[model samples]
Target: MDNINVSDPPARITTITSKKLSAKRAQTRIQAFLDDFENRNSTLKGGDKTVTVQLQKLNQALLDESQKRRKSAGEGR
Candidate 1:
C-alpha cells in the first residue's frame, strides 16, 4: 500500500512511514511493536504462527519496495 503523507492519520490506522532504518533497527522496532501489541491484547488468538506469517509478509514487502526503489534510481542514470 502507498504511504500517505497526510499530517494526521485516523486514530485506528497504523502508519509506517518510510525511513532510513538499518536492518537491526527495523527488526528492533518491529519486535517492540509486536511485543507491545501482544501485551496489550493478551487474549488474542492465533499465537506465534500468526506473528510469523505477518513478519514474513512484511519482510517480503520491504524487499520488493527496496528492489523497486533501486530499479527506479538506476533507470534515472
Candidate 2:
C-alpha cells in the first residue's frame, strides 16, 4: 500500500435519565418486597407509610424536574 489515512471520532459522554433510574429502583424494591413477603414475622402494613412517603417525594421531585425542563425549553424560544 502506498498511503492511507484514518481518523477516529471524538468520544461523547452519555446521560442518565430519571425514567431509567425509576425502573431500576422499582426492580430493587420488588426484590426487597418479595424477600419480606417470604419472612414469617414481616409486617407489610408498617412499611405502607414509608412507601407512601417515598412515592410522594419521588413524585414531587419528578414534577419539579419536569417543570424546570419545560421552563428552560420555553425560554429557548
TM-score for all predictions?
0.43, 0.40
> Residue by residue across 1-77, what tens digits does model 2's lDDT show?
85544575657889775454553455456556645654643566354456545655665566666678778989999
C-alpha lDDT of residue 24 in model 1: 50
Can you tell me which runs of candidate 1 are displaced by over 4 Å? 1-48
Counted clashes in each candidate structure: 0, 0
Alpha-carbon deviation at 3 in model 1, angstroms? 41
- Assess the local accuracy of residue 52 in candidate 2 as a C-alpha lDDT between 0 and 100: 45
Q: Write the per-residue lDDT of candidate 1 for residues 1-77, one digit (tens) a residue.
A: 99877898667966688668965556567667767776675756645557655975675566666678778989999
Looking at candidate 2, what is the lDDT of residue 18? 44
Clashes of 2: 0
> What is the C-alpha local distance difference test score of each model?
0.69, 0.59
